[model samples]
Target: MYDSFRRDGVWPEFDRVDRQLLRAAKVDVAQVAAQIPPDLMATDGPRGVPPRGHDRMRLTVAGIACCEGGREDLDLFFHALRWMAQHEARHYPEPGKTSVKVTRAMLAKALRIPARDAVRLRRLSVLLRDERWGSVGSWRSTDDQDWSVNVGRDVRYFRRVRSTDDFIAATTAWLEPVTVATPAADLPGAASPQSPAEHGSYVDERVFDLVRQSDGARWDCTKLLALLRELDDNYRAGNAYAAHALLRAVMDHIPPLFGETTFAPVANNHPWGKTDGRYMKRLVHFRDQADDVMHRQISRTPCVLTMEDMPARAAVNRFLLGCVSKLA
Candidate 1:
């Protein structure tokens, strides 16, 4: 969308958000530049977001020619991704669809190479360069929902990592690519060819400990409370909750949201003659009636809450009392 004040007056950034997405696709900039058609680059209409850095490939090759890659190969590169996306869209339409991977895997196996390399292995790789690829714009923490998606994986380096700003750095790296061609020295590491024993050793006791932590109920009850608290904070911060997600995300080396584990009940209950308001027996999740024994934190702005929230707060202090009693 283009805007007089915006970068493109007719082609505003968010207007074509999916077009800006770069997950997995032609990683080489020079090759990408050679592959894309001017029509694809032109600000026209709704465009499909391709997997594995497809956004970068789209940008690099959209309207330009490059030093590398013949036009035929470039065309093939675009077609290959189209074919992959078509196969995926037709067969699988939701998150974590296996059809795309399965199709790519079958093709890769027929030719004999790893899956990621299959991207670089295509004839189009010859044309793509490093500089052609870049991130759309700012980083969002919510992108973690698609962390395992093909595009998500390709853009993982751009998401929150060791540094919350890692995504920007990584995107910048791709944007300023010297070449898509890997330096021979970094090739071995980049290729990700792990031998059996080396790979096994990589998953040492530390890894096991981490894996155990996800499903582990072996910790002191106090730690369990800590975990619950963390989940509470996450929900408060606009994240959905499932015990599994909480454990899995926390245990993972890189979690989207970290450093919060405070659990508090959002409802209240009492046993006595009816007081100020209606006395409900069961736990109502987020309803808070200050008029009654039950109190509710007024639903504040900047928070997405459900209408079905229970007003009852957890018996946290009571539970702690139980824990202390057990200790005594």
Candidate 2:
């Protein structure tokens, strides 16, 4: 994001101001600044709060609704997901990073449940009421102002969901690792996930299934390749996570169960033929070698060359892009 203040010819670069003029400016500056509302200030203040202090601190239902913009359940899941994601981001100690985009299907497979159930479970736990202490440390004594208003009493709150243990378990496991371990440097892929037995289709939260999964059949490789030319997109990692809601699935529809040419390390190999359109062959070969550690050949895989078991940083964004850009 472009900072409003970071534009050209803005603030002075030097800090060599004389003390006398600085003192006079401070008082005048205070008076001038006070004319604006406290919300304009960047951080939590003597009498106000900023959005960046802690997880779930500055979040509002309005902000969540605007950003995620899905069914009540997916909206809630996204709200919770973004909150937890932002919290994890703060302790990351780096600017840009790559994190795996494990699908609900993959998660369901690990958790041993149905995919529909996995998605339902994910949608159910939209609000972590117990986890939220207070908004901005100001206690809202009234239930109307409480953040958990929609948690227990809402009717459309994934009506039949008892407890989202499976979804919670899957995500909890997926996110617990700072880095993955393997026999041969483990190339930092996704964690050992939990799953379900059956796979269920997804519901379009915004338009009552107007955008169905079956819609993917409308485009072939030629059409999808043409679509990519009309658009190019990028999403920043972890901070806002807003862009993910709009663009994540656009790519998801194009990629298969586990094949993305841009992300699966087909081009970055020794004499690997590119025109073959067989990235899955390379992935299966490398992933299989890594899984079978008899010869320690997993380390030789191009994708895991300098990373951990899954190459989280090296491949995630490309995978996301490939999902958006169908093979063409």
Candidate 3:
């Protein structure tokens, strides 16, 4: 049986006994069927069994047993079956009764194996078929053709039985791991406000931290970070208009605690405090330019923000960071 399995390179179809066992264990047969390789399964019409060649089958009955129960359970199952195969006369002991009625204690004694936990042994027992004499016993005795027919029928039933809701339920249970948020301080290859290498650039890592620390009711820091990340991407892609719009969005989303309704108030309240009015004046001018472009307002000259205006962008980022600091 082991040699045939190794040579065939495809897992043999589960027999009546296997299906009954799986059902008794409350295993999701459909889920198990879904995992089976497409080519391994039998299809209808002229294409009988597909030639497997030399490719080794990946799954085994032992693997299925492991999925349903743990490794110890599989070991118990294999050991019990081996015992049954070895000691036929001890249990049956009669010619008329072809079926072996081997109890757990009898099987354990035959193999000289240690007694297993009752619950686990009960689950393993399902693998043994219960029926009239010759018709029931070890899977080894079952005809391959019979096993294939049973397997094919069950696969079809599972495919047909499963609904859209079943799929949704399975997917919901099999959820992807939640991603842990990365600290902006740990972000590499990017210039942050605290970094000395680029003092003039506007990348405030603290903004991310502030947003994360804030109570969700007060601010949607996640949305803020997403916008900031997109703004950075747009700037790198040379979409200055989009970058400016994203900056305007950032300004708009500032928490009410900052006491700033518009970009002017934040920019004017800079520590330089109107002493350097150029930053505030340039910010207002850029805001108006972005608004005009977005609203499709006609201008005498084509008023567009571009990469050349990065200095003003950096200054605005500094002012925004100042607003974020108030929340801290």
| Top of the candidates by TM-score | 3
lDDT of each: 0.31, 0.31, 0.47
Q: Model 1 compared with the native: what TM-score?
A: 0.18
lDDT tens digits by residue: candidate 1, 1-328:
1111122211223223434333334244333434546444432233443223223223333222332333433444344433333333334334644222323334344435565543334323322222222212222222212111132123323322222133236557655756455544575555322212111111122222232334334333344445555544544443332322443332332111122232112112222224312222232221122112222335564433321232222232232222233222
Using lDDT as the measure, which candidate wins? 3
Report the candidate with higher TM-score, 2 versus 3.
3
lDDT of 2 by residue, 1-328 (tens): 0111112112111121222235756533233334535332321234443222221222222322333332454344444443333333223323343322223343334434464453343332223322231112222223211222111111122322223343334444444655533433354653322111111112212111122222355444443333332222212122112222222323334444235433234333323335333443444344444434323444555532211232232233343333333322
| lDDT, candidate 3, at 291 | 74
Candidate 1 lDDT at 27 equals: 43
**TM-score, one value per model:** 0.18, 0.21, 0.34
Q: Which stretches of candidate 2 lie over 4 Å from their true place?
A: 1-128, 131-313, 325-328
Question: Which candidate, 2 or 3, has the higher lDDT?
Answer: 3
lDDT of 3 at 20: 55
Score candidate 1 by lDDT: 0.31
State the weakest 10-residue window (summed lDDT) of model 3.
148-157
